[model samples]
Target chain A: MSSAAQGLRRTGSARRQPARPAWRERPKPATQAAKAVALAAVVLLVTVPFLIIVSTSFASNAEVVANGGWVLWPQHPTLNAYRELFDGGIVTHALWVSAGVTVIGTAASLACTIGLAYALSRRDVFGGKPILLLILFTFLFPPGMIPGFLLIKGLHLLNSYGSLVAPVLVNVFNLVVLRGFFQSVPEELYEAARLDGAGEWLILRRIVLPLSKAALAVVGLFYAVSYWNAWFYASIYLDSDHWPLQQVLRTYVVGGSQLADSAAGDASAVAAPQTIQMAVLVVATVPILLVYPFLQKYFTKGVLTGAVKS
Target chain B: MAIAERDATGRTGAAGASGADRRAGRKGRGTRLTRLRRDWVLLALMAPGVAYFLVFHYGALAGNVIAFKDYVPFDGLWASQWVGLDNFQKMFGDPDFWSAVLNTVWIALLQLVFFFPVPIALAMLLHSLTRDSVRKFVQSVAYLPHFLSWVIVVAVFQQVLGETGLLNNVLGDAHLHTVDVIGNPGAFKPLVIAEVIWKDCGWGTIIFLAALTQVDEQQYEAAAIDGAGPWRRFWHITLPSVRPIIVLLLIMRLGDILSVGFEQMLLQRASVGPDAAEVIDTFVYYKGLVGGDYGYAAAAGLFKGVVGAALVFAANKVAHRLGEQGVYR
Candidate 1:
């Protein structure tokens, strides 16, 4: 480094920086500037692409083309793209499909996982250890894709929505989390409840569920995000018409196929396919963004506890 | 639920508290039957999940028998002509399967070298920040992308880096040659690794960040008092503290090396062609699901599964030899 620049960085106003603990040394201004730049880059790198998609989705057709495909910010924001999407067309149907699957799938997954985790959390439940062993072994060597597909085919779940949720109803990781959280609850509490003649379900409902709200929310969010984002299974299992939003987005947007004009009746001045694609992207993404923030803090606890265990 | 305090008729009143203790001494079939009758409700609770694992996981697992059979759909999975090692021999000879294996390993290696340490570095940087609000805000923004579907992530990348994408548009305005990335086979690997990094690097920081947060402040303080600088403190305290986690995660990653983002590659496989994107999973998808070559595909998949399971066992053995807890007991 140049001596002058080094000297300036060393002598840069430390007053502007936050106070550090006595044991910690203040970083040089150059280091601070570099850190700020790195953080900003990290933040922007993640956020800018989403911004461009949203901006272009909302941008008018002329503005998008004028900017040569994508607009960073719209000159005149319009809801036409979303209007086309929600015009009771393929995308609208897909959105509903996705919402239904996420809701129903999350509920089903949470129920099964809770039951299994709670049952297994108790010390001497019949066949608890062996059942856990059976489940955990699947984690080590999961069923091969081909065999799994054949099983689905054999079961006649070829075009059924149950194909999506049934195979993946109870995620082992989420089960581990709930099990760990359930196990952590005091034995004394279970003792107290059992003394009062509380049944296993009663204790689980009254004590375990209330205490495990954070873990449940996090697990529910994971399941919802997974179901929402899933398309590959839908691609293989269901027909295009029954695909969720993610699968349709994959086909039309990423696959570069055009949306059929007849689905969205009239007034279709034919916006750029890129705009429509971005609009679909936003629509597919908004649900996750809406639910994630509320359940964000619980992620650390839920993930770490489960992760640490296995 | 709380209102129902009815206990089972025959079992002890304080059943659960002494359940594990009593079971330790009792091994009789009579006790086992007693235990079964006693825990019927719990058994009922576990029925759905157990049935799922049994049917979907193990039952599908049993379907691997088709790997040794010809798997004629008309003759059915069971009555199909047995092929013994014929499918394996075909998979061994077929250059496409080998290429898919090669691609999977190549991608997995690329991820290990380029994508593994990202969250570690990001975690350390976030840990060093003094301002709580800045740290929290940056974290919120950073991990948000992890929630997006691969389809959306791929679209975002295409929108930004494709032929007529933003970068090209800027280059065209400046009269510079626009780079072709989306379709360039050579760029496919880097593009994939970049997407993985962009989508998951932040989320990956969670474990390492948790590790860092648990580091004792006194270690840094003591290091400073001993005249150790920032780099020295980081090397001595932070690195050593998270080393076990890093090593554990590395072992887990190495064990599952054949998996290289199947859906992500499948989404973009058509754009760049299978040569650039056919990992083992995709190969199986195409060969089995799409092309109807069930027996051959199942053989290839079973091969991958066995190798993966063996690697996990080998890695776990190594972990135990090194005195780490490993993935499981």
Candidate 2:
């Protein structure tokens, strides 16, 4: 009787608690304050360089030079660096190439990966186990640089846009993740479709694709980012004019080419290398920043579930 | 029990409906043909995928045999002269190659030690937060760096620490002596490690976060009721829950000790000089691709691959012995 009464008392006391308490049982205001401070510190450490660049990109040459190469906030922010970059046509052209590669590459990758992942997901599919082993074996022993490069060259793919798309169309890791996700779909769904007289294509298009949206999105994002950031292959397979924005950024930032010759600008503004580099950095990062928030939720679940494999 | 019986009935019914499928199995030779015939649609669906592997993956694997020969583009892979272990010997004798191997191992070890724990710590902090909104906000902010390119990452580091960059500028403003951080060999290792942590530490938290979610809330409640302190409860409950994940990640990381991030190292190699930054991947790129010493680079590549596979096999064996579920069967 006392135990029942105690249970009732505990339930009553729990109901009395507020919907959302400002603080929990520990009451570590000092600790939370310290954590908040520490988190802010970490964020600042990661973000300050970014801030400096964006601020410096707009700063006047005199201010930047006088400030000994950086301005925390532009004394007078200007779009002169951007104007020069756009006028040069190189940055504009490279931007288009990068966007094209990302779009085409992502589309091709998604289609092939989905097709493959879907086929492999079905346990009763002919030769599925061996095919999966074949794919997984590549992850274990990746084809070396010389061999991979030679294969591309042998196919007469050098200097062709197809080189970028064809060689890396389907990442095995992405494929495996997608396959795992596809496999997780209830067998009853496939059976239901089969009973409804749906063929493999109809079932894939109607049933599988809808269920695998999160996996597809995550895989698509990985492909797109990889294509955007890829410069090594472009360096090997592409001519100088055909290089992507990353390669262009690499040339400017790492190679230390002045933005002056590209445009006959006020040497002072162009002379501030800090802002110019930051402008490039911002350009490189803008695509990811724009797309990341929308796909944030998929990342938490989609990534790890896919990553459960070795 | 009823469901199992019903499933068996359904299976038998399905088998009865597909008479030819069952009948063909009675004739052993015909069963193979029937199985192939039945899966024709699946094969059609899988054609492009198989073609991809054959062309890109297996095709590339076949090309690795050139490591045994003196490869010439004009003469081609098959036509090249056979020079068996000479390439491997050259790679072994090369001091530069040895140093690259050393640098890769050292950097990987540092990352395993320093960068590995930060994500777990961050995840714990996020887990402990009372407000869900705050935790989500912190995670969103932390994950931003992971998506940024290594070029941008390197550029960010350079703009902040390069000669006439932000750090020196700040120091100058304060009337303090400037420090040369960027392009300094002494600081290069720390710079690479820091960049890696900034870029990937948050991404690493995803697995840990997933692992943490499976922990039962009732355990925490019981611990609290039992008057166990937060620290004690954390040690007893939370750590044990996530221990397998930690062990699994460590084993996987150990297997990949030779492959530090390729693009990151490649980008910074020129700045820091090859001594500090030349890892196995970059060394292969320079020697095989740029210098056209295909055999030597291929030999080195094969060597790394062999070691990696061996390590994975060993790690799996060890995990099984320890009574833990490993990466593979």
Candidate 3:
């Protein structure tokens, strides 16, 4: 046996083979403790704020005020904040806008990206090299803000929903990701499909896409998240009545604007501003939290493939 | 179509006068035609994306003409009077613009110094873990914040560190003095950098972790048998393995130094005022879009873009000099 294998076996005899290489002796206690501390710090740093946000959103107004604007954990959880949020006002409307934009934008972006990426992945496609360089050149030197804003204004998309989608229809990074995944599909499978007289669309649908579900899901999630979280375009292009949930969150929560005017006529005068703001933050964030785990499974594979191949 | 087809067939016919020429040229043109015809579906599929780039990117590029014009909204782009370098000259003379430039550079340098190495360090910590489940769970938790919008991230910070936030609450309960962090002009740069590190350090680790996984197992084993300890093995094996990626990411960071969080800064710009918060992008937004000084704003933006593009080229050249591929060929 090779010395490495023998060493591993010898280490195996002493205890378990180290989860990494046999070279790692069991980590010294200090190393173990340090790692544990680092892990705990990371987890707590990420989770504590979420915990506070959710808890404060569910806390009673009196409790929130008494606790100085945040609740680590609610004494009595309540949905009153959420009810007030959806009481047919700006937050509810913005939530619908966010959902609609995310759904439509993700679908359109994924379809366009997949179609373009599939086309570009083919070796015999006409003008592919120049087209790719053109796309990539934009990545290097993006069109500046004033010009972009002017283009949107010129196209009469300033107040339209198309302002958000049109300006960022297909991200080149996502395109490259999908293209890398498509190129990784075996040439033999493509040749086989072509030999069967399958058209490009059919090949993409029946062959390429099926093999690319992980990549598509990851890229789709990216599009969905960006569209969902987008506030800047909405802030600039649309009026207050057409803002998305993120923009609403930005205005009320981060912008520190009192919602008293927005909630002026609402029946739920009992809900505190902190509660409502936290509720809005949670509502804006929850959809991504829900979708993240599934797509996260593919993130490493998808991103690495895209990064390495590109 | 008719003219092209007739030309093609006529050429084939002319080539047909010579047997060998006819076979080669006719076959070549026929296959080329066939290939062209076969690729129509792909071309059609590419149309939306191609059109999107043309209209949004190239069309926007064309709109950069306003930088040279004394633009009036009533007169529109074409009717505006051309003023040559007047807008640029104005920008060069504006102290606010220079302050914004300085702030941008300051924030970017702080991020480079403080935030850049965090992921590499975190990746090392995660890579040393002996348990799979712990590592996976930590990775998932850490990467979660990366997907949160900057608004949410900033709000999270406010909830944790603002005057009436968790930190103050704890301090109040303990009868201690409270620290003002959120909206404090003096603390704005560090606060923004801290937020960036919190949001991205985990996501950044993804690439380094991937690099770590690629470090050869044999190297570690060989080093261990040779009496090297963990730190030595890590220094000799792990760091060297990920050096190329680290350099690549560093170059990319250098190229992007001018853009130090537009949305994040915009969201907080009002809180800290322009003195502490203004950057090139926000300056452009406020000047051009909000203030209606379109020509001047466009000029400032064009300057930033030109310098940024130049930086990218220079950084790429430096990378090539160091025997790295950098971003492109």
Candidate 4:
């Protein structure tokens, strides 16, 4: 088709035009150096604290104390702090709680979001526009903290794990993102599926979901991260026994409380509090660090599609 | 057609009934039944999401009624005595409430003035990178902090800038005066603003970088060919292209100005004390949850919610007047 030829010609012209355009000329040496220095500063500002935290976590107790509570690099790397953290105590329990919440919540959230988004993505679906607006309106005027608290209390969900997941089951933003992605599917494909006598559910199961794996992964990661990072709800709703890791982290680390209290035993047997704190920080942060790179490339496209379309 | 005609005419005439008309009528009813059957699955699919909104959002919205009542835990929400704005009257007269409002507005303004432009500048910096690989590397490193929980972020700040933290340690080693950045009430606002900038500026740049990409390469080339310098081209072409996005974000920021970071302040509030750190949200948490003055706190919260919603509407109106797309049409 002529359209294919035009696309080829466009690519050909794009390739040719980039060959030394005036705007593409290299900047002056001074300007280049300044840019490099500015960028290096930005990179350093972000990376140094992480480096320090990792180093301190690995540092020996004596070295950490001698270095005045932080180590740039470990003199003697040890797993003593991490070992203490997982020795079946508060941190251990909280880690399990956080992991369970994240996995189950992400699955549940993604399922609900996909179901709703897919239904809404179809043109002329009954009451779809009203439902979409109803959802979007919540974003503009959120129920404040007090009322939200009261509702949770009234539901008798206080001091319960359900408080964490039930109150924030589906993020409207994620739903909107998935809806936009679903809407971008080609109409002709739907017609073809319909011609084959496939129902909406069959088409969704076979075609739409398979095609939206990237978006699903991205939204799932977002949900997972939110559930993992949530501490405020846990702080308010759950008692100390049921607190998740971030809430534990908030209480002992950021709140500057005694580690012995949170660890639920005598303080004499444990390693340095600084080391344990850094280890806890490392434990809290490591999962996101591990998963970030693989999903990093999807961030722009995934977020922008939602941002633009919505 | 004959059966339809008979039905429409309200005549009982089986002899005039045609096969096609009977079939058409039956087919119409069949299609309706089929459509209803098909829609049921979609409805079933949408049920959970709709129920979540209804129970969590709308249901919580209904609970705002407790603001006008003496909310007793034993009596529950409905059985509580109605005091009809006594809670609001108490909140309006409370000096502590005013102080919290002052702190919230002050911090919000500080963030607006200082923290708002960071992402734009960072985006411009990244956008100007001629090498794609370098841009990618820098971007990956930059956005890492945004994903961190405020707990972790506050902890990191404590470790690096606390009284005995890295900076103080380094200063002590260098025979310099050590500074107390964390836990210093005087430094809390700036410190919080700095934390906000460090955590979010890079992630914030995503939209602006996206906006930057939409700037026309042809126009830049044209400007360059006409001897327009880099700065001039950027000012003329790039800034204008991203201005609408900047405006849109500004409106959103204004709407959210009342919040000014609840979790961030909450984490640090006890250290600095409420005088320097009590934003509206933290104040609400302390008074309602900790102090158990539920009715008064709920009234304050309702006040915030209504003001926030109004601000959003007003900001959107302003945005529309300025010839930009607001959050909604």
DockQ of each: 0.37, 0.35, 0.40, 0.40
What are the per-residue Cα lDDT tens digits for candidate 1 across B187-293? Answer: 99999999999999998987777666556676788889999999999899989877877778888998889989999999999999889999999999999988999
Candidate structures ordered by lDDT, highest first: 1, 3, 4, 2
Mark the regions of model 1 whose C-alpha exceeds 4 Å error after superposition: A1-19, A264-267, A302-306, B1-30
lDDT of prediction 1: 0.83
Candidate 1, after superposition: displacement of residue A151 in Å? 1.2
For residues A240-296, what per-residue lDDT tens digits would candidate 3 score against the true structure? 888999998998889898676455228556888899999999999999899988767
For model 2, give the interface RMSD: 8.4
The local lDDT score (0 to 100) that residue A151 gets in candidate 2 is 92
The deviation in Å at residue B151 for candidate 3 is 0.7
Model 2, B6-125: lDDT tens per residue?
322343344334432333222233465786887777788788878988999889888888888887777988999999888888888999999999999999999998899999988887
Error of 2 at A244 (Å): 0.3
Candidate 4 C-alpha lDDT tens digits along A5-74: 2222232334334234655567789988998999999899899999999999888889988889999989
Model 2 agreement with the true structure over A1-310: per-residue lDDT tens digits: 2221222123232332323332226557798798898788767877787788888877777787888777788878888766656665677778899999999999988888888888887665678888888888887777777888899999999998899899898888888778767766656666677777787888889998998777788789888989998888898899877988998888888767754464323353454666666676778888988888755757765343434563
